[model samples]
Target: MSLGAFFLICAMPLLSGCAGFGGNEAPPPRPIVTAPPIAVQPPPAAQQPTGVARDPSKFFTPAQMAGRPLIRVAILLPFNSPRADIRSLSNALYNAAQLALFEFNNPDILLMPKATGSAMLAQKAAQDAIREGADLILGPLFAEEVGAIAPIAHASNVPVVAFSSDTKVAGNGVYLLSFPPDEDVNRIVDFAVLRSMTKFAALYPQDDYGNRVRASFEKAVADHGSQIVTSASYPPNTEGMNLPVQRVASYGGRHGALLAKRSELKKAGDAAGLKAIENSDTLGDLGYQAIFVPEGGTRLRALAPLLPYYDVDPRKVKFLGTGLWDDPSLAREPALEGGWFPAPPPEAHAQFVERYRRVYGAEPPRIASLAYDGVSLAVALSAHAEGERFTTEALTHPDGFAGVDGIFRFLPDGRTERGLAVLEMHPTGAIVIDPAPVSFGVPPAL
Candidate 1:
């Protein structure tokens, strides 16, 4: 498909069905020219259906008025969920969206913040939105929640920009405004290849998240004309990481080689050579030149030091990681001091954080920036479109958008493509070694 067409995946064939919720109990969304409003919860999850989408106007049916017409944008999230941790993240995102709306100060749009306590609630909320005459939809944070909202929104022909990262829930008229690991790995691998680090390896965790990361990493490596010399997985815990580390270092094979070298030196009675061999570490070259650790936070902190201890020293093998490495606390970890990872340019996000803190009176979560970007994109599109906005063509603009992170746009496959940078972990802090792309571009495929 063409680049522009590739972005409007919803325009192609209709293949999606999303569930939803509706109720007067939802937080009423006010207009931005009057912006409206966080909360926390935990994580757990996980599906969806397929069908042709219906015309949006058939259900939206908002009557035309003077000046800029007021459009209703639904903001579905689990504001009152059971998990406080998840609630915090979702609330931060909601606040970020509110911040964007406040900044936009666009009197033309009325944002509706609906508390989607569950899939059933989300489904009802969406159905209620259809009845209320919504022109657009902003989110339903979780994948299943997005599914609940989809069928109602699509059948009504209303366009949705869901915050869920699960690509499986994307399709029909729904667009995912999430940073999936697939894009993260693809961008990092591209950066790795550009650094001339061809040989690759991955130390993965034994979990579904790790599975996705592994698949993305493999495809990215292959696409860049590189190969994974070693790939191994370990349990989620800190202990027993040895097997994966040893496999990557080729510990058994190298030990055998070391013994053979020692035998040769001993047989020849070369005292100086024997001494040098004894003092030197294991075989320096383990084939792969770079190793990717698809982990982050304390788990990553625990896993990184093991590489060198297991003989895969930074001096020999370059350590790589995903965007998960973009954490302030990580700078304190000496083991990750020389590692590299992919993320959006930090300076832009720093500006966002400062503004968010000032407005919200507290620091927002890292992922919350996405909500700001998503809402900002909505505002940008709806500002002067005269209701023509939110269409596939308008939503999938080729220029993409300049958000808190960087440039990003939608794809025909119902996925988001973001321009990311290659960051280097240092003792001081993580710095952008490579800036995100200034323009939109497709990621290379395997």
Candidate 2:
């Protein structure tokens, strides 16, 4: 099996493929959009302080937009790779940009190509478009491809809005429009702290996705004054019962890795060994009351039952996860009775699904939502960023625009301020348990 499969197998339990929700709630006739919206709650308070006030003049002064030339914008995505769902991705990006453009009625905005199918092709395409007087570029979706072109675009001073979740590679003019699971992990820890669930124990796969989320969760927890009592990482792929069983025996001890005291590092070998097992629990032991899992929907279902085997009662412990667990399968899993995961409102997703089906016959894929949001956001910027200079003043206007994802605005630092809702998973299905909007504080003074 592949490394991804290997890691996932070790970290999660075996389960059948997810079946649709088992409820009388008909999949709410597909929305005109790909997914329907969750029942709308009262909109959260607007104008809440972003915690950081930005000096808008630094990025976009009034003098910038004046008399700038109109420039074309290029959007490139792999629409031909053998393994990729090119048509769906391309259509979602195209449709989203088109939808936003239609509302703005701007003639300067131009969509570059139908789509590029490979990284090499996308790089060449972007270069060609830039030479052809394209002012700004949008997309080149995959992370590896984005890394390949970001430097090229940065050198040319052309901004790109890429649908890549790897924040480590994003820089100067390249804004990531994709949502990283790491960000969700940070948000989950923040919410966990607010609820006074401090001691955390993590069991995550040792891979890029899992490691990224683990780091963010640890950072957030520490910042919030909570402690990570124990954190045990499993190899990316594990099979049979031996792996988890052994991991439990090795890492769940009173003097396990997590319980080792940092202050005792200078001691002799005897002290170090002793510290490693301090405050640790026995095998199949759960040392913390809260567990933050960063996993895909399928993996989450597999890991659910193991919590109890490790002496962690799912009902008693607060389980936190990301939008990855937004699927109905999570709610239906008996072992995931009290899990809480963050997700965009269901009604909103339903509506988008309906719209996508109406436009293209089938449901929009999950990743397609990011493509849609990315292009729509870029189109919003293009509508007003006329002439030669893409004015920061226009992009960060006091009155921000709403997009398919949510109400949002662009920060001068190239980060986006998004409004997201948290969903709670029940045995039957998920409900929008928390109505509060997570505010990405405003851009810091730059």
Q: Name the best candidate (by lDDT).
A: 1
lDDT of 1: 0.74
> Please, what is the TM-score per model?
0.82, 0.69
Q: Please report, in order, the local distance difference test score of every candidate based on alpha carbons.
A: 0.74, 0.58
Per-residue lDDT of model 2, residues 43-158, tens digit only: 23222211122232322212433444444667776655555456556666665555434433445555555245555655665666566556667777777777666767777667
Poorest stretch of ten by lDDT in candidate 1: 12-21
Stretches of model 2 off by over 4 angstroms after superposition:
1-71, 84-108, 114-118, 236-242, 245-285, 392-401, 436-446
Model 2, global lDDT = 0.58
